[model samples]
Target: MVNKLVFLILSTVILVGNQSFAQKKITLKEAFKDKFLIGVAVNRSQINQSNQEETKLITSQFNALTAENDMKWMYIHPKEDTFNFEQADKLVELAKANDMFVVGHTLVWHSQLAPWVFKTDKGDTINNAELTSRLKKHISTIVEKYKGKIDAWDVVNEALAEDGSYRKSPFYTIGGESFIENAFRFAHTADPEAELYYNDYNLINAEKRDGAIRIINNLKSKNIKIDGVGIQAHWSLEEPTIEEIETAIKMYSETGVKVMFTELDISVLPSPWNSPTADVSVSFENNPTMNPYPNGLPDSVQTQLAKRYAAIFELFNKHADKIGRVTFWGLHDGLSWKNNFPIRGRTDYTLLFDRAMEPKKAFNAVIDTVND
Candidate 1:
């Protein structure tokens, strides 16, 4: 009887240990496999597979990959006649190897665009014809190169202002609204099979949401192949209420295209403006108060972050049919762009994984939203 009791205790201990181990194996991609594609924007280090730990985390946890900066115009097509395919090729190759869905970050954007694209050799802004030729060539070359490998392309990014008007970017100035229309057309011609999307930030605002819808309507009117709209979800702890997000998702889907939370990262820091903005050009002088959690996020704030992520995921799950994909901007907190955006050199804990690459409370909270 004594031996049997001891055996029973050991069996219970082993069973509980196995259960814990099994629980840990549930990855983000697996948890949301039926909902949407789990994705992360990967940088050069990860694309090159230099950091084995991060690469492993990426392949195991996420099923979709977006090249953070490598595929952007400045990096991919820096000159009128020159095209750089080194890094972009590696990123596509890595994604293919992992059986991951690849996103070509952007084909046209005002920011990070090469000056040569709009200027003549003599330093004058090129004519509309020249600009159109350059835009077509740039989009065609890149899109056709990875036609089938790249699952989607952010055809035009941040082309509208916060108030719902077209941003007077050089693209708009030179080519008018036809610039956006032409971009989608050019990409579609290059790879009719690949999905093309218009990506923007601050889309939760009512006016901006209407602006995105207008773009979708215009594209569909012309029979352009615009597959989705990417709302950059660079949100904060308590702004752009959950209702606003759900409404935006529903509205975008109603336009006959899918919705995507393309670049998601919930910042725990204070906003510099009245509302959340992912305008990379915006910056503020760093102050101690703004960088409140320099040492590390306190437990209270961490709990808040967890709950915030949970609420957001719950909404995503609620409308999973509308959302085609949800991608985090980076893999871990240490690599998050929030650390330098708006205020440079500020330590901000803004990702599901902490600096050590360990899954934080927010990560577990996101998983529980589905599992529970």
Candidate 2:
């Protein structure tokens, strides 16, 4: 009788162990398979598969990929006549091999642009006609090369000011608002099947959100193929309440285009400025207080991070239909731009994954939102 009992107990333990293993196997991609794609912005190292562990983690957890900087105007077309496809090509091939959706980061932007794009050999500003021609050539060349492979393009990035006016960028100065329209038109002409998006940060603010809508409506009214709006959700622990985010999502979707949470990361550090901003040019001197938690994040702070993520994901789940994709800015905390952005040499725990590539409390929290 005792022997029989032992055999039954052993069988029960084996079955329970298998069930536990299965539960742990559920990944971010698997959890949101029906709702939307789970994507991560990857750098050159990740795309080249140089780090085996990171590559494995990326393939296992995510179903979509965005080249963090490779496909940008400055890197892809550095010189006026020279086009470099070495890294960008590798990224596309990597995405294809993994069967992941590919997002072309950006075609036109005020920042990170090649110098020659707006200047002559004698350091003179180019005319509107020359600028427009250069813009068309740049957009057409990149879009046509990976026409079918790239699923979407962030055609114009950060073109709107905070007060619902056009950012006086060189593009705007040269071509006015027609630059945006021409960009979308050029992209569509190159690849009619690809989706085009206007990406900007701080879009949750009422005025900026309205500005984005104006751009969307303007494109639609002109019959331009603007398909989505990418909100660069570079949020922090205590700013931009859940209601604000949800409202922005609803309002953007009401414009008849999908809303994407692109470049998503929640910083767990103190902001130097009073208001939230993601302007890359802004910087401050780092103090010891600013760089707190350098050794590691405390359990209490980690819990806050986890709960904050949980609430954000719950909101994302509630509006899944309107959200096309949710892409984390980087794969791991160490790779996050938050560590140095706005303040240099400050260690910030912003991403879902920790520095060691292990899923942190925030990652589990995000996954649990769907699992529950």
What are the lDDT figures for the candidates, one per model? 0.92, 0.92
Candidate 1 per-residue C-alpha lDDT over 1-372 given as tens digits, one digit per residue, 9 for 90 to 100: 999999999998887665531266589998899999999999999889999999999999999999999889999998878899999899988888889999999999999987788888899989889888988999999999998889999999999999999999999988999999999999999999999999999999999999999999999998988999999999999988999999998899999899999999999999889899988888999999899989999999999999999999999999999999999999999999999999999998889899989988898888878843
Q: Worst 10-residue stretch by lDDT in candidate 1?
A: 16-25
What lDDT tens digits, residue by residue, belong to model 2 across residues 105-128? 999999988888899889999989
Question: CA shift at 155, candidate 1, in angstroms?
Answer: 0.4
TM-score of 2: 0.94
Off by over 4 Å in 2: 1-23
Instruction: Give the C-alpha lDDT of model 2.
Output: 0.92
